[model samples]
Target: MTYPSYRNYVREPVIKVAGTGPARSGTEVWAELDRAGRSRSDRPLIVVDCYPGVDLSDLRKVAERHLPDYQVIDVEDAAALPVAEIDAKIADNLTDDRVFGVLGRQTVDDFYDPDALRQVRDQVAGRTTPVVLVGWGALLVGADGGQPAGTGDAVVVLADMPRWEIQQRQRRGAPNWRCDNGAEDNLRKIKRGYFVEWRAADRHKKHRLFDAMDYLLDTTRLAEEAVLITRDSFQAGLTAAAAGPFRLVPFFDPGVWGGNWMSEVIGLPPSDTNYAWCFDGVPEEESLLLDVAGTIVEIPAIDLVLQRPVELLGERTYARFGAEFPIRFDFLDTMDGGNLSLQVHPLTDYIQETFGIPYTQDESYYLLDAEPDAKVYLGVRDDVEPADMMAALRRAEAGAEPFDAEKYINVFDVAKHDHVLIPAGTVHCSGRNSMVLEISATPYIFTFKMWDWGRLGLDGRPRPVHLDHAERNIQWDRRTDWVTQNLVDQVQRTGAGDGWVEERTGLHELEFIEVRRTWFTGPVEHDTAGTVLVLNLVEGAEAVIESPTGAFEPYLVHYAETFIVPASVGRFTVRPSEAAVGQELATLKAYVRGTERAPVGRPVHDTKEPGLS
Candidate 1:
C-alpha cells in the first residue's frame, strides 16, 4: 500500500486559529495578546521564532508596549557550539531565573542539532514564567516533536505564508541569510527543506506540532484574517470548517504554448506572457479554505481526504486509492493561443516503473468553450509508420525542418460540450482557440512530449521533448480508426425526471472513470453510492446542493465551479438557485465506475464491456 505524504495526516488540535499572512501591526498583536489574557506587566517570556524572511520587528514593538520592563533576546546571538556545549548552555539558562518573563527569539534552521532542541524543551519545563517560541521550525523544537513542553498554558502560534510569496520576496532581493547560494538555488533549498528533509524527521513529532497548534496566521492576502480552531469546530463536519461552497486557491504558470484566456479572464498580474494552465482542482498541489468564525484558513486539500477518507471517498474508494483523491480537475486555456505540445502520458505499469506512482494519467477533455474551426490533435494516421514518425519528430527537434503535425496526427474539429477521452498512450493536444476543462486521474506532471511545433517557450528557450519515453508508452495501434471510434464518447440517455434528463457521455475500456451530463429546470436527486462525485456546473448560472436530512450543509455553487459530493453524504439534491429557478441547468458529473472496473490500458476498438468481477 502506498503511504500518503505527511500533510495528509491531521488530528484535532487543542486550539487552532488562522489568519492571513504574518505581517501585522503592533496594535493588532497587542489587541490579540490582550484578548488572550496575556497582557500582564509580568507576562511570561515570549519566544518569537520565525521562518526565514519573516519580519518580526512589529511584533516585538507590540510586546514591549504591553510590558515596558520586558527584555527581548535573539537566540541567534547565542554562541553556536557542539551539542554538548549547547546542552550545558540550556541547563545554565534554565536555572539562572534572571531571564524570567523575558521574550526570546529562536531561529530554527536545518543546521540546528535536534538534540539541542530537546534540551531546550527540558530546560523550559516547570517554568512559572510564560514562554513563546517563534520560527518556522520552532514547533519542531519547542514542543519536543509534539510532546507537551510542560510549560504551563504555553500557547503555540504558526505565522504562515505561501511558498510563492516567499519566492517572490526572495526574487526582490529580500534577505535570506541562511543560504549562500543564489536566488534559484535558495528557492530549491527552501522547498527541499520543507517537502523533503524536514518531513523526514521524527514522524510523531511532526504530527504533534500541528495537533498542538493554537493558531495559524496566514499572511497570503491583504487584510489578514485570523481563524480560531476549536475541537467543536473541527468535528462539527464540513459545514463548520468550509462555511459554504469553497474554492481552492488556484495557481497559474506559463507554458510553451501559453494562452491569453486565463490572463484576460482571471485578471492575473502581468507575467512573462499569457498563462496556460490553471490548477483548479488538482488537490495535491491545491489548498482548501476553512472559514472559522469568519476568518479563512488555508490547509492542504489532502488533509480532508486523510481526515475523512471513508466519508469523502466512500469505503470502497478509500480502500482502492487510500488517501489519494483519484480525480483531478484543471483548465487548459488554448483560447487565442498556440497549440499545446504533441504529448502522451505513460501507461499504468510504465508510470509505476518509471516514476513509482500507483496510477497513470487517464485524462479527458470537456470543451467548455471553443472558437469556430478549433481542432484537437489526436492519434496518428492509419498509414503512418512509427519509425518515420519518430524520425520526423527528431528532425523537428533538431530544427532541421518544421514538423507538419497534421500530416501524421489525426485532427478533429471540436465544439462546446464535446467530451473526448484521452486515456494514457493516446497522442493528444488541445489546438488553439479552445478552453478545455481537463478531468483525469490524479497523477499529473508526467507528460512525455513527442513534439513541439518548433517554437520557443515563454522563457525564449526550445522546450524539451521526451521521444524515447513517448515511444515506449505510445499505442501505435490507436491510429485514425481507433481514435474516431473509441476515443470519442457516445452520449446515451440514462434517466429522466420532471423537467430534467440525465445522460451518460463517457465510459470506456481504457479507464474506469465515468462522466454523465444532467439537464434540469427543477430539482434532481442523486446518490454517491459509495464513491465520491465531482460535478461542474457547465451550463447554468447557479445551483443549490442540499442533503435531504440536513446531514450535510447546503452548498451554493456557481457556473464553472467544481464541487465534491462526499460518499458519506450518500444522497443529495441539486436545485436551481432562486435566480435560476425559471432557467435550465446543465451540469457535468464525473466519478470512478462502481463496478466493471478495468485496469488502465491503451485505447482500442473494443466493443465488449469489461466484466464487473
Candidate 2:
C-alpha cells in the first residue's frame, strides 16, 4: 500500500466507539493515573514508551502540568546511547543514499546503554513516590518490554505516533528521535524514519508494548492537547472499526507539480497550493480516528494490521503477507498541472536484493477524471534504442541538453475511467490534466525518477534523478505495440445483473492485483472471499455500502472516496444511496489476484455503461 481526496471529502472520518466507554481525556486522564498510583503498594512507575518522532515536548508539558508530584525521568537523557553511537548502530540500514534505506530489524534495547539503564533502574527502585518515565524507550528502563520487573509496580502507556504526522513534523523541522538533524532534506528525513526509526519503533511495540500497555496515547496533532485512552478501549475501537467497511483518515499534501482538481472537486479551501497526492487507503501512513463519546481519538491504521491481522487481512492474506496491508489506493491529480516524473519502479528481485524489501511496486492508474487533452506516458516507443534513451537521459540530467520524451516514450490519449496497468520495470507517468486513482502493491517510495521535465524542486534544488537505477529496471521490450495491445483498455465484461454490470479491468498477468469495475443502478453483491478488498466510488455522487446480514452498519461513500472491507467481513452489498437511487454509479474494486471468485463465465466485450467510452 502507498502512504501519503474530494467531493467535500470527509476531512476527518471517525469510527464510532462501540461496546465500551469513551476514551479518557483532560482531567479524567489524570484521575485514572492517580487512582492507579494510589492503589499500588510500592513506588508506582508510570512509563510512557513513545515511538520515534513523537513530540516529547507536548507530552512533557502535559505531564508536568497534570502530575506535578510524579518524578519525571527523561529516558533519553538518562539512558539512551549518544547520537554518534545511534548513528553507528543503524548505519547499515541508513545507506549512503538520500532517499532509500533498508528496513531495520532492531529493538528498542539495541539503541540503549545497558549500564545507563541499570543506573536509571536503581534510581527508580530507590524512589518512594510515583515515578513517571517518558521517552522513546522508557518502558525498557524498568520493564522487560512491558512485563513485570524489579522497578516496582509499573503502568505502561504506549505513546504512539502515526507515520503521516511524523512526516509532517519532519517537514516542519522536527528531527527523528534524538538525531538532531531537523533541517535535513524532507526526503532524507522520511527515508530515515522508514528505514530505521519507524521499523525499530514498530518492532518495539508490535507485541510487547501493544499487549502490555495500560493506555494508548494519541501523539497526533502535536500542537493540540493529547488524548489518552484505556488499552481495552483502544483495542475495542480497532476491533469494531476493522470489522466492517471503513475508511482511514486520508492525508493530502501539495506537490511541486500539483493541481487544483482536488481543491475544486474535494471542496478544499481556495488556495494557490495544489493538492497532488491524497493517501486515501495506504494503511502504513494513515490513521483511524475513533469517536469515543464526542471526543476523537486518533490512532495509527497499522494498529489493525498489527493487532487484528487475522481479522483485518483474513487468514490467507495474513499467511501470505503477515501483519501487513498489501494493497493500496491513492490519488495522483495532475489536473491543470505538469506531468509527473518519468519514473520506473524496481523489479521484485531488484528490490529484494538491493533494498532488502521483499516485494516490488506493481501499480495501475485508473483515471477518476481526465481533461480531453490528457496524455499518459506509458512505455518506450518501438523505434527507440535502450542505449540511445539512456544517453539522452544522462545528457538531459547533466544539463547538456533537454531530453525529448515524446521521441522515445509511448504517450497515449487518456480519458476518465481508463485503467492503465503498470507492472514494475515499465517506465510510466501521468500527464497533466488527469486525475489518476493509483492502485498498487504497498511498496511505494522506491521510484527511480529518470526525468523530471527539467524543472527544479520547489526547494530550488534539482529533483534527484536516478537514471542509473532506472536503466537497470526499465523494460525496453514493453514497446508501443505491446503496450497498446496488452495494457490499454484491456477490459472484459464478465457478468451482468438486472441493473448492474461487472467488468474485469486490466492489471496484466505479470502483476498480482486484480481490479473489477462495477457499474450499477441497483444492489451489487460482493464477497471478500478471504482477502481484504479496497475500492473507490469512481463514477458516482454517493453510494451506500451494506453488509448482507447487517454485519456492519450501512456505510455511505461519496464520489472519489476510498474504503476497505476486511476479509472477515465476508459478504457485503453496494447500492446507490437515497440521493443516487436512480442514477447509475460505478465502483472500482481491487483485491489479491487469486483470492477473488472466478469470472461468472467466458469474457464478453463492449458491455460498458452508456456513458463510458
Candidate 3:
C-alpha cells in the first residue's frame, strides 16, 4: 500500500573530514567566541535578560572558575535599584569606567503601572545596553498564554518547545512549527531567534509528522511504522492519561530502531534530548505503549549552526571534531503482567561475531513512570555452579521448569528521578508495569535473551527467543550476586563550579562536558583540552565570553553552545554584565580527558559475509 507523502522530509547531508579541510579543534572554536566578546568591550551596554531554566548559571560558574573579577548578586535584594531593576543590579557591580554589559530580567506588559517598564527601557536605551533579550516563548507569550512580550533592543528566544502560534500563522496549511523551514528568517528577523524550538516532532501534529514519515519511507525505500496513534487520539489520551499520578510525555521516537514499545522515552525537546523523565508501571496488566522507533532524526555531522542563534552563525563553532550527533528513541509501558527473559548485551567481540553490528550496550535507566509494585531485573540472583547452570538452561529449553525465574534474575524496585548507568556486558531488563527512561549508545538493540519462560505474544504467537546467542555471550562467570545491592552510590549534584563531575563507565569516563546549574558574575574561564565542550542549560541566565583577547556577545539559556577547544588554544576567560547576581542557571559538562583510549575492534558476526572485516 502507498503511504502518505511529506513535502518537508529532507535527509540531512553527511559530514566529511579531510586533511586541512572543514574539521577544526576545540581551542579554535573557543577562541572564536572569545574574540567576539573581546571585540565588543568598547561598546555601550548590552542588557541581557537572564531568565530561569536557562544556562546562565554555567556561564557564571565558568567565569568564576577562570576569571573572578566580575561580581554576581540577587536581584530581589539589590541596593538603590535602578528604574530598570536588571540594569541597576548589574550597574551596582561596576567600578570601572568601561562600557557596561547587563544580564538580568526584562518585565514589560500592560499589567504593570503605565510607563513603568517604559521608564526602565528608556534609561538603558542608547546606552551601553545593546539589549539581547533571552527566554523561552518570549515571542509567543501573549498568543500562547506565556508571559507578555518583554522589550529588548534585540529579542532572542531560548525555548525548549516550538512556537506553535507563529508556525501556524506563518506556514500556511502547516500542521505545527514550520518556522524551521525558513530557519534563517527565524534567526535573522527582528522577532526571530526569540523562540528555541524543542523536539519539532512533539509539538508538530502526529499526522504531519506521520506524513513526513511516509514521505521519508517512500523516498528512502526504508521500512518503518506508521504514526503510532493519530494526533487527535494521542492528544486526547495525553489529557486523560496526564492527569494521574504518572504521565508519559513524548521525548523521543523509538521506532527508528527495532523497539516498538520497549525503548527509551525522549524527554524535554530534541535539543535537550539527554534530559531524563519517567514512565510508570502498569497495574496487574494495564499498558501504556507508544511506537517510536520509526521517527529518528539522524544527521551525519553536528555543527554549531544546528543549535546556535542566527546572529552567531558565521562566528560560532559547533565542536572540536566539527560534528555533534543525537539519537532518537521511543518507549512503551505495561502496567502489569510483566513477563520477560533475563537478557544480557554482548561485548564488542561478540557483537562482531554474532550480530554483524558494530555497537556496545551503553545505556542508562531513568524512571519515568512507576507504580508502588514496580521493580526491575538487574544482574543475577545467587551463585550457581557452571554445570548446574548449564543443566538448568537445558531443562528450561526442553520445557522443564528446572528453576524459578526470579531465582536467576535480580529484581529491584524503582522510582522517579533515579538514574542507573548500564554498561556493556551487563545483564538487565525492566519489570512489568514500570516505565523507564532508557539512555544508551547510538546503535540499535542487541539482546541475547538468556532465559525466557516460554511466553506467548499478544497475537498468541510465541515471542522470538534467543537462548544459543545468550549462552555464548552471557558473562556468567562475572555475574553480580544481587540487583538492588549494586545500587550503593547515589547521583549527587556538584556544588557550583566550572568543570564537570565525571562519571567513570565502560572502559572510559563519560561526563556531560559543560556547566551544570549555577551562575557567574565576572570573567568566565575554561580549559577544554581539544574535546567538545557542551553547555547544556538546565536553568536560565545570560553570559559574555571574555578572554585576555576581548569579549564575545551574550547568549540566552535553554540553548546548548558548543565551542571546540583545540590543543593549541591555552587558557581564557568569560565576563558577565553588572546585573549578574541572583540569576538561576544549570548545565551538564562532558569531555573526553586524561590518557586517551581507543575502542576495541571486533569482527562482524551478524553480517552475511565473514571475511570482509
Candidate 4:
C-alpha cells in the first residue's frame, strides 16, 4: 500500500452543473452577484448566453449601469450551435490569463441530458478561470446518483457562502486569489466523496526479501491508482493528495481467489499472477498455485522473457496476452560456495522434434541482493568434441576443455542490483551467497550436468544432474565468453546504440524483454494488457495503489511483498508518501511489454502451448 507524495496537497476540483434553463428572479440576481464577485470590475465583463428567451446582452447592459464598462456576447440559439463549433468559440474567447466565467443551462428540454452537461462542463470547467454555475439543476460528479452534484454524507459540501465571503473580505483576501478546495476559497462545484485510505508499514519481518516484495507492491500500487484515476476526476485528483515517506493503498488481492481465475479476475498477465513466493505459507500438498520462490503459474521469474507491464499515460504503446497453464518450477538459494550441475537447455528446434514442442528456454538473472565475488558458470571456455565431453561425464571427471567458472561464466562483481541474461544454449550454474530474481521463458529446469564431482544437497544426498540432454545440445564448436561487455564490442554507457534502451539503472527493452529502474515523483497511471510485476526497494519512500475495489497499503521499502498488476485492470498509479524525498522516491525494477510478438510458431518444451501457466 503506497500513497503518492504529490497527491497530498493538490486537489482535483470537479465542477458539477444543474438545470438547463435561464435563472429565475432570485437566481438571476444571485448569478449576477456571483459573476461580479469572481471578476475585476475595472475591466468589461463578457457573457455568452445560449438559447431562447435568455439574453446575455440584457444582463451585460444591466451590469454596465453599475460598472459602466462591460462586454457581453449574446447568441439567441446556443443549443443549435454544433458542439465542436461551440468548443472552438469557447476556446477563442477564453484565451490569455483572463479572469473568465461560464454560465450554461445544465439541462435543455429534449436536447440536453446529464452526459451532455458533462461534456459541456469538461470543456469549460478547467479553462474558465473562475466559474460559477447559474442553474437550479443538480450536478453529479462522484458516486453516480448516490450523491447529487452538491449534496450527501458520502461527500463534503461547503455551503453558507455569505459567511465564508465575509470572513475572506475581513482578511482582505485578494479577489483574484486562486481558490483552494476549501469553502473560503472557491466553493467545491461537487462535494468531496468518500475516499479510501490505506495504511503503510514501516518495517518487514525480514531484510533479504526486497526483490519479491518490490515487484508485488510496485505493480499492485499502479493497478490500484489506475482504477481510481480513470473512474472519476475527483478520485484522480485525490491520487496525488496523500504525500509520502509512508503511504499505503487498500485494495482487494484477486490472488486470494484460487487458480487461473486470479489472472482473469485481476486482469493481469498470467506470469504476473502466479508466484511460488506468494503462496509460500500454503501447504505444498494442497495444490498450490505459487511456490516459495515466487514462481507463479509454475513459471520462474528468472528468464529472458520479462513481462512487467506499465500502464500508459496520455498516449503510449499497448500489448496483452491471455492466460494459459503449466508454468511451474522450484528455485534454489545457495550459501558460501553454492553448486549447480553444468547443464544444457533444449533449443526450440530440438524441443519441437523430440517433445513435439517449439519453445526454447531462455533465462536471465535479476540479481536482487548479491554477495561480493559471486559468480555463475556460463558456456565452456573453449571448443571440445561432444564425444569427449560425454566420456568425461561418464567417468565423473572434469573434461579437458572444461570451462572455469571465473572465465567462461559472465562474471560480475555481483552488486545488489546486477542483472545478467542467459540464453538457451548457454550452459550455466548459480554460484554462492546471492539473492536472485530469475526471469525465464518457462519453469522447465531441464539441465544436463557433464560433471558434478559428487556434490551433496543439504539433505545429505548427492545432488542430481542430467547428462543425456547436455551431450545432445552442447555447442562444442562455439564457446566464446558470455559476459555482456566482452561479447558486445561497443558497450559505451553514454553515446548511443540500437536494439535496446539502457540507462544507469541497467537495461530496458533488450530484445523482447525490458527492465527499467523507475522513480515516481507523483502517482503513476497503469493500464491493462499483460500482467506487470515489480521488484522494488522501499528505501525511504512509501508506495500506494488505488483501485475500484478500494485502496491497499503495500507500505515502505523495508517490507517485502510481491504486488501484481492484473492484465484486466483498466489502469492504476503509484505515488510516494508525504515525507518521501522527490529526488529519492521508491526505486523500482520494472518490466513492460514490447511490440514483437512472442515466437508463436514454436510450442513450449516438456509441456503444451506458448505461454507460462
Candidate 5:
C-alpha cells in the first residue's frame, strides 16, 4: 500500500494579520455593534448586507439573542422582487443550455422593484426603535448607493462567504437567490451561479460593500459562528498577502472518475467517495484564511485579486487581463480510478465568437505520479478520414456500439515527470493511474467533452457530450507522427549553475504561458520579471522559498502543494529545507509570457500516411 502520498497537505492555509491583533467573536460582535449604536442617534440603523448563499437563520437568532430591544428586518421579505419577475429579468443570461450561459450584467438593484425599495427605505427611516437591516441586496435601500438611508447615524456590516462554499451548499440542496430550485441538478445550479448570480453579486459587492462597510463578517465556519474584523484590518491583510508568497485554500471534490490519490494524500473525510479534483491555485472559487491573533477569518480569494490587482498580478498582466488571474494550477487524479472524458478545447476564435470568452484553454499536463503501465490518449490515428470519424462518433452516441478508441487513438506511455503539451483544438485525455498537475489559462470551465465511454455520472444520469462542438474544433493535422514529435516531453536545458539547473518545457507556440523547471541541491535564484509566478513542488520532500534581501518571511512548501509568488516580490530564492538538506529538490513554475519569445517554433509537419486498422 506504500505510495507517493504526501499526507502533510494543509487543508486551511492562513496568512498572518499585522494591524489587528485579535478580531471580535461570539458576543463581542454584538457588543461592538451596541457600542457603535450608542454613539449614533437615539434610534440607530444597523445595515447588514450579505453576499449570496449566507445563512440568515443564525444571523437572525444571534441578533434576537443579543440585541433584544432592536427591531430586525429581513430585506428579502421587505423589498425583493417576486420570484417570477426575478426569473424574467435574468432569463437572457440563464439561457436554455443547461451547462452554459451568457455573462450577466444586472446588478443587485435589478432584483428589486423601485416601489418596493422606496417603501422599505421609508419604513426604515421612519422607525422609532433601533433597526437591523439584513440579507442579500440589503444595501440597495441605502441612499448614496452604500450609506444608511441618507443618515450619518448608521453602521454597515457585510456578511460574506466564498463561492466554493456556496457550491458545496448547493450540492446539499441549498437554493439560489430568490429561486425555488431546491431540488435542481447540481450542475445546473452551478451554471446559474457562475453565469448569473455570482457575476451580479460581485459587481454589487465590490462597489457597494467592500469599503463602505464598517465591519466585515466571516460566516464560512462549519459551526456557523461569526468572525468580525474591522475594515482596516481586512484591507491590511490583503495588502500584506500581495507582497509575498501565499497559497489559496485548496478545495477537493468527488466525481464519477475520481481516485484515491488525494483521499489518502490530503487526509480527506473517509465517508465521502474518492477525490477527483483539487483547485489549489484558483483565485476565483478559493478562499484566503487570515490568522488574526488566534481567530481565523476566511474571505474569498477573489477579494485580493480585486483589491490589489496591480500588486498581485503585476502592471503588465493587469493591463491585459483586467483584474483576472490568468494562470491556474490544479490536480486531476485517475489513480486506481477511471480515465477522464475524451475531450477537446475550443480554439481562440471559436470561443470568442460563440461563448463570448476572449481566451481559450491551452493546457499542459506535468505528471507528478504514474503507474508503470499508464498511458495517455493523445492525437488521432495518422490516416483517419474526418467524415468517417464523425460518423463513428455519432453511431457511438446512439448506443450502436462502444467506441473502439484503441483503433483510432494514439496512446503514449507516461512516467513520473513527463510533460505533455496540449494546445487548443487537440484531442487529449489522461488514461487511468496518472496524477496530473494541470497548468493552464484560467478559463477552466470551457472544456467540450466528446465522449464519456458510455458511463453515467455519479448522479446516475448520462454525462453531457458536446459532439457538435467537438467535431468542429478537432484538428485533423494532429496525427500520430506529428504528435509524437511535438506533443510529448520536449524539454531542453536552459541554464545551469552550481548545484542547480533550469530547463525550458514546451507548452506549444500557440499558448501564452511559459514554463520552467528548476532542480537544485543548493540555492536557486528567481526574479519575477514583472509578472506573477505560480509554482508547484514536483520533486523532493520539502523546500523553502525565501527573500534574497530579507524582504518577507521564509515560506515553507511541501511535496505536492502549490503556491503563488506575487509580482510585487521582485526577487526570491529557493533551497532545500532542513528535512531534505541532501535531496535535490525540483519545482515546476509557470507564468505569462509577457513579451518573452516562445520556447519553440510552430510544427511544420504534414504527413498523409494510410489509416491504422
Candidate 6:
C-alpha cells in the first residue's frame, strides 16, 4: 500500500459553488431575481439553458408573468436557422433599446458550436443590461469551449438535478426535440446524449463554470434551496471541517437482476421493475453537498480531491492514487429479485494495459441483509474443468442447453454480516433475495460478465457477455479450496473495552482494503492514521461522529448511511445517539492498509479493563 513519495500531480485552483435543492418554482425564480437586485427596468435578459431532457416551458412562463415588459424568446423557435445564423440574430438583437430583455432557451447540443457561443458572449459583454444565460452546457463547455473567462460577470446558476429525476422526466414525455418524434427515438437520443456525449465531455476536463459560479440552486428536492459560494466554504470541504457531514445525492438504476429492496427500505416509489444499484459513494459520478450559511450547495465530488488532495485523501493516498478516490461503496440489491450476472474483473496490470486505468476493481461483497435461501456464486468448483465451463457457457449463449452454473461455480449459503471477497479475476454473483454492499476499488464499469441467466435486460435485449475477456483473466487456481481458505474472512477479536468490542474481518493479499466490525454500547475512539476511512452504520439506528479536537461539528449518520473520516481529522469518536445508547450498536469500518499493525483504536494491553484479559 506504500508508494514512492512524488508530488508530480497538481491541479490548478478553481473555485465554484454548486448547489442542489427542489426544482425551482416560478415564485422562487422571482425571489432569486429580486435578491440579485434585478427589477423590471433592469433590462435583464434571462437565458434559461437546460439539459436535453429538461422542459423549461414552465420556467419561461413564470419569467414572463413576473417581467411582463421583457420580451420572451424561445431558442427552439429558431431551430430551423443554422447555428451561425442564430448567433447572428442574437448579436444583432443584443443592442436593441426597445427590448427589455431576451430569454434564450436551448440544450447542450447548441453549445457545441464554439464560434456561435463566442459571438453570443461578445454580444453580452458590450450590453449594459443584465443577461442571465442558462444552459447545462454553459458550465461544461463554457464560452469558447475551453475556459469560462468570458462568463465571469453573468449571474450563473446551475440547476442541479439528479440523474434519476432526468430519467423520470424523460419517461414522462418531457418536451424535448427527440420526444416529439417517438419513444424509441427519444430513448436512443437520450442514451447517446447523456451517456456517450456528456460523459466524454466531463471525463478529464474541469468545468470552468464551477469555479466561476456565483450561486448554485438545488432542484433535486421538494423545496428549492440556493447557496452562495465562497472560497472559505470550498476550503472547509476539502478538510472535512465543513459546516456538516456531506452526502452525495444517491441515484438508482434498474438492471436485469434489479430488486425492490431499495424502494421498500428507502421509501422510493416502486419502479416499473426493481432497482438494482445505488451510486452512493462513487465520486466520479457523485456530487458533494456543501452547506453555505443555511443553504446546501452541491458540487461534483471530484473537485474536492482535485483542489485539496492532501486534505481529502491524505498525503499518502493522494500520492499513490492522485485525484482518484481509490475506494468505492455501492449497493447491489437482489432482494425479491433475480441473481446478478456471473462476472470477473480484470487484474491491475491487465486493466492498465487495456483500459488505460491506473488500477483495477477488486471488490468484496458484504451482505447487509439476506433471506434464508440467499447464496453467492463464487470461485469455481474444485473438480470442474475449465474447458467444460467454457463449453457450457457457449452452449447457453447459443440457446441450446442452459448453463449448469452451480456445477462449476461454488454456491455458498450466505447470511447477514457475511463478507465474501471477490478480487479481480474471480467469478462471482450475488444471489436472489439479498442486499449486498459492494466495497471495492473505484474503477467501475470494467466488469467482464462471463454468463447471465437466460433473461433479457430491462430494455428487452440480451446483456452483453465478455467470455473472451473473462477467460483470460479468470484465475483458475482460485478454485474451491483456495477460495475457502483466503476469500472468506477469518474473524478475530482484535480489541475490547468497556461496553465495546472490535473484530478484524477482512484484509487479504488480493486487495489493499482492510475491514473491521465494532459492536458497542457506548462510544468508541478511532484514528485515521493519515488514511481516509469509509464507515457504515450497518446495525445501529443512528450515531454521531465528532472530532475530539473540536475542529469540525458533530456529524450525524443514520442507519445504512455511509460517511468518510478524512485523514486530516486524525482522531474521532463514534457514539450512538442518546436514545440508542442503551442498545448495542454495530458499525463496519474499511480503510486502505500501508503497514502491519493491529486494528485502529485497539486498546493497549495495559489499558485493558481488569477482567478483559
What are the models' TM-scores?
0.75, 0.95, 0.37, 0.39, 0.94, 0.75
**lDDT per residue (tens digit) for residues 1-613 in model 2:** 1111225468788898876666776767766876776676456678888888888877777787788888888888889999899999889898888788888888888989989988887887777777888898887776433334323467888888899988987888998888889898988888888888888888778857886788888878552366888888898898887789999999888888898887777877665568889999999999999987778899999888898988888777788888889998999988888899999999999999888898889999998888889989999999998999999999999999998999999999998889998999998989999889999999989899999998988778988888888999999999999999988999997777578788889689999988889898988877787778898998777898887688889999898899998888877788888888878899998887776433311112334443221
Candidate 1 lDDT score at position 584:
84
Best by TM-score: 2
Native-referenced Cα lDDT, model 5:
0.83
Worst 10 residues of 6 by lDDT: 4-13
**276: Cα error in model 3, Å:** 16
Kindly list the per-residue Cα lDDT of model 3 for residues 1-613, writing each as its tens digit: 1111211111121111112112112233223223433454432221222222223333234323332332222111222123354223334322121211111123222112334334433433423422222222222222112223222212212211222223323333222121223323221221221211122212221212222210110001011211112223222322322221111122222111122122222222233112222111111111222222233211101112232212111122223212222221223343333534567666767765543334455555544456677666666556656566656776876777744656666667776434454555566766665555454443333556655556643324444456565666655544454334343134433222332122222111332211222234334444333322323222224343333443222322221222222222223433333443445333333333331121111111222332211
Q: What's model 6's overall lDDT?
A: 0.63
TM-score of candidate 6 to 2 decimals? 0.75
Q: What is the per-residue lDDT of model 4 for residues 66-169, given as tens digits with 9 covering 90 to 100?
A: 33322222221222334454345434322221121222212222223445555534533333233222211112222223333222211111110111122233
For model 4, what is the error of residue 12's alpha carbon versus the real structure, in angstroms, after optimal superposition? 35
Q: Rate the local accuracy (lDDT) of all candidates.
A: 0.61, 0.83, 0.32, 0.32, 0.83, 0.63
Q: Pick the candidate with the highest lDDT.
A: 2
Q: Which segments of model 2 are wrong by more than 4 Å? A: 1-8, 143-152, 596-613
Query: What does the lDDT read for residue 260 in candidate 3?
Result: 19
> Higher-TM-score candidate among 1 and 3?
1
Give the distance in Å from residue 530's predicted Cα in candidate 5 to where it truly belongs: 1.5
Worst 10 residues of 3 by lDDT: 214-223
What TM-score number comes out for model 2?
Answer: 0.95
